[model samples]
Target: MKIQGKTALVTGASRGIGRAIALELAQQGIRRLLLVARNRQRLAEVAAEIERQGVLVVTLVLDLTQIVGVNIAIARAWRSYGPIDLLVNCAGVAHQAPFLESKLQNLQEEIATNLMGMYTMTRLIGRRMAARREGTIVNVSSLMGKVAAPTMASYSATKFGIVGFTQALRGELAPQNIRVMALLPSLTDTDMARGLQLFRWVLPMTPQQVAKVLVAKLEKNSSEILVGWQSHLAIWCQRFFPSLLEKVLRIVAPLSLSRSKSFGEIANRQQATGNRKGFWRIVLDFGFFRSNIQTFDKGFDQGLKDKFPD
Candidate 1:
């Protein structure tokens, strides 16, 4: 769909990928934007920036985990902006713990925020889009959604659910002329990654880069766009060599376990005083997987160049 003059609602717009998407949309001349997130102050800051760009901006303080709040926010956006021309479901959370030690609550929270919340929001907005017969929905998924990773079972499960959900929604919405697209970005440099203590790998794309790719792909109504070469490799490996992939993951599992143990120590120390600070301390000390990022970035850039080859 053409973004110019369109109205868009973007969840998790306070920072990271969502923030980048909002800015990109604004740059495209999408004159009206509804920014949704739980932090009112941050949401206001984002709105201010977008408004400064000379576009209409609406900010909604919403905890997507609360179904009622999401519904209310959708209603408010509809009342304010009329029918939403685009809906970007970007709010999500991740928690990493050993399968045996992970609590039921943690898993449930992941499912609720990442899976069910998207389901709820999509159902509400999708019905309106169908009725209008003109809209676009972009669901931000992850590489983990395609491959199961050690200590990220819960995250992987939620992402996998997104892939299925987006694909199914795409098929269902095809007849209505409303496009449903899934943008599967691999490790990205974002606050969510910092919160999850996942700084060991090189993130192939910055949030801005991912946003650029997403906007370009959305223009074409692509069903799914995987953002990085590593992601493409993971999908291919899973398809052609599942057993070898499992063996390789087993070999690399120990390094992941060691990192998790270190994070667990920090968690324990902080828990004693109810302060969960210094969780990212290890990333600075051990120089995060910068080489991996360079490698992935080079591959991604080369692939893009080859495909576009201007």
Candidate 2:
């Protein structure tokens, strides 16, 4: 469908890929945008930016994890600005940690925000779209959805769920003329990914590049949009060489875990929590497997370093 002159509701619109998408939509001459996120100030900032492009902007401070609250917010937005032409379910939370080290609270937060929140928003807007018989829904999934990564078990689970959900919704909504699509982007240079320790050769793209690719594909009736060559390659690897991919992941699992631990430590330090021993705690918490995994990771790390010396 044509993006120009369409009213779009974009969740997680305060920053990162969501922010980029909203701006892209504006640049494409979108009539209006309802920006939903927990950060009201940031939403206002984004609104101001979009306003400069002459697109009407509405900010809705919403915490997607709260089902009732999300429902209420959507209802209010709809009442105020009738008939959403497009819906972008992009609000999500991601946390990286080994399953053993992951806090239950953090895991729950990820599920509530990334999965349940999206499901709720999709269902609500989707019903209206179905009734109207014309609308588009874009669910921002991730490359991790196609291939689970170590130290991101919970996050990958949610993203994988999104892929399945989008597929099912597409089938159900197609007859209604309500388009449903999933966008899978590789590691992006967003604030959310700033703390992640990238693999040796993986290149991260900017959010703007991802947004540009996705927006350019909006007119096409594609079921899934892979933002970069990396995402396409990763999915291809999973499809044609599952076992080889598994072996590669296993080789990097220990390094991924260390990166997660390091990121957590950095976060703690930034918050001035002074938890200097957190890294050792992560190491010891895994028990007997820790040493063996570290040894395995060390050999592979050295090999990679030799092959791709910086």
Candidate 3:
């Protein structure tokens, strides 16, 4: 699909990869953008940035967890800004904790935002897109969607759900000339990435890099856009050497557990000291935090980089 002159709606447009994608789309000549996220201030900020690039931007301060309100907001935006030609479901939240230690609320919120939110937006926006018989939807999943990690079981579940959902939509919507794609970005340098405990060999990329890849994916009309070589390699291993990947993950589980504990400790200290940041925000904001093992995993990092040079 031609990105220029299209109106795109991007959720989670306040920060991180979502924000990057919005700007990229604007730069690519997207005529209008409906920016959706909870933070009105941040959304406005992003809107200003996009507007400066000569693209019209409208910010919707709606929480995806509030399904009814989200629907209403989308309706309002449609009424006000006209039909959205492209939809980017990017609003998401995650909580990093071992399965045993994960709180029920955290799990529910993760499902609500990461999985259900995408589903809700797609259901509503997709209907209109299908009616028009021409549109595109991009669902942002993660490398974890393909391969689960320790202490991030629930997050992985939600992301995996997104991948499946996008795949299903691809089949259902293809006949209507509506395209659906999944974007599986690895650890990107963002606030969200900074909060996560990552594996030894994982290297973080900038959100701008992800935004650029998104444009390329749009032009190629690719179904699955894996942002980094690390993601590509991981998925390859999962398909051809599943047992080896599983074994490596098992060996790393204990380290992941320790990282979870450290996160818990930090949360406790923040609470005790009355830090402005919420405990779960700190605990769940594991964007690209290196696993302690990464500090000493020189050969693993070097070998992977040598194989897949930047």
Candidate 4:
């Protein structure tokens, strides 16, 4: 709908697709933005960029799983910054690994941040919007939500949950005149994606591309907006050739080992990383890492072995 002069709140605004979307919203003439993330420095960096575009910005360093804090923060932001007309739930964490190798902690983190966090934000803002009877909400899912991938089982489950929520919420909020939509971006070239093993043929889209598509699609009545040509083709294949698509997915799935030896062994092999970067800091600090890191290391080591055969 109409974005100009409206205020929006975007979670995960510290980086990746969320940051890009926040910037694009500013560019689209949204009057104000309330940016939320766990990292204050990154949020400030994003706020600076958005301010350059002349958008009023308010940044909140938050961990959405904290229910009471979220309640207080959201109420305060609404009172201080004014009511948010649009809410974009984009905060998420991904940990890729074989189902058997997955950890409960990582899965909990995924569900907590991706699904519960979105739910909390939506519920808080949604009630206000429903009262006012005019607002828009966008849930950022992933292509993996539509087509599950092998190494990314838990992450896929959380995304599927988001897609499900978007669908159900759309029906639930329709009578109140509040709009709910899903944005599915395929294999985005984000910090989270880079930590995983690359699939054979699929290409990753930049966060900016995803943001541009979201902004453009908001003008339409479409319930789901998917980014990139690859996503469209994959979804089309999934719709028509389910069996063949499964086979193709298997062929392109990343390498996985049958067993994990030990956590220490995996940590040592992380030598490939001289100094872990910002992404790793976020994940590790949040306890968001899984056997996926080990899986990636082993796969990388095995690929080297296969290529040079010592």
Measured by lDDT, the strongest candidate is 4
Summarize candidate 4's per-residue lDDT along 1-310 as a digit string, tens digits. Answer: 9899999999999999999999999999999999999999999999999999899999999999999999999999999988899999999998878898889999999999999999999999999999999999999999989999887899999999999999999999999999999999997777777666656456567799999999998889979998899999999878866655676676567554333222223233454555444335334432323524554455546645655576
Candidates, ranked, lDDT: 4, 2, 3, 1
Candidate 1: what lDDT? Answer: 0.78
Model 2 per-residue lDDT tens digits across residues 105-138: 9889988999998999999999988889999999
Q: Is candidate 2 or candidate 4 better by lDDT?
A: 4
- Cα deviation of 288, candidate 4, in Å: 31
Q: List candidate 1 segments past 4 Å from native.
A: 199-204, 252-310
Write one digit per residue (lDDT tens) for candidate 3, span 127-207: 988888989999999999999987789999999999999999899999999999999998776777656654443456778
TM-score of 2: 0.83
Whose TM-score is higher: candidate 1's or candidate 3's? 3
- TM-score of each candidate? 0.81, 0.83, 0.83, 0.83
lDDT of 1 by residue, 1-310 (tens): 7888889989889998999999999988897998888899889998899899999998888888888877887887798679899999999988777788788998998898888878888899999999988889998889888888777888889999999999898888989998998888987767767555443433336789889998888778588889878788878867866655554454333355445434334445556767633434434434444324454455556655655679
RMSD (Cα, Å) of model 2: 7.5
| Candidate 2 residue spans exceeding 4 A from truth | 252-310
Residue 22 of candidate 3: its Cα lDDT?
94
Instruction: For candidate 4, give the lDDT of residue 253.
Output: 71
In model 1, what lDDT does residue 209 have? 85
Q: What is the lDDT of residue 81 in candidate 2?
A: 90
